[model samples]
Target: MKYLADVTTIEYNADKCTGCGRCIEVCPHGVFDMNGKKAFITDKDLCMECGACANNCEFEAISVDYGVGCAAAVINSMISGGEPACGCSGDDGGSSSGACC
Candidate 1:
């Protein structure tokens, strides 16, 4: 899914990471790879903006503004005048649509 604004530029706060592999395990796009002990954004552009890494991270080390890079959500927000409600609005929902189902 091509996004208007690539949301793959992930922000990692090393201080917050606990070296947990949950993010790595859950990410469908394989955005993260373990570096020593902590997780790192190995492939930023390849990231689907899926927040699986962020959601699964207990330490809150990973964060991104958009999730899943869904054009539907952006279009919905543009037409509705508010943030889209496709579940992955920001930092509070699953990265996949499967969560909605």
Candidate 2:
């Protein structure tokens, strides 16, 4: 399931990257790619602004406009008496993640 990703606010400051590859590890959309020792934004539009990469980066190298998308899902789930999910169907045909959408 693809989220309606528009122009994202995701930004990558390579100078701040510690070469830990944390951003590379957490981006669900493969938005970040390693340029040898540092990471750069390979595709900004691929980002859903889920904040997963930003949340995991201890070095503060990656930044995204958070508190939307998944946050909206959380609020909607609460209002609708449902659970927050990533919308990815598991092998058993169920939601795979309750967080990090």
Off by over 4 Å in 1: 1-9, 86-101
Residue pairs whose backbone atoms clash in candidate 1: 49-68
Which candidate ranks first by lDDT, i.e. highest?
Answer: 2
- In Å, residue 78's CA in model 2 sits off its true spot by 18
TM-score of structure candidate 2: 0.62
Clashes of 2: 0
Q: Model 2 clash pairs?
A: none
RMSD of 1: 7.6
Tens-digit lDDT track of model 1 for 8-53: 5677888888887888889877777889987787667776656677
TM-score of 1: 0.67
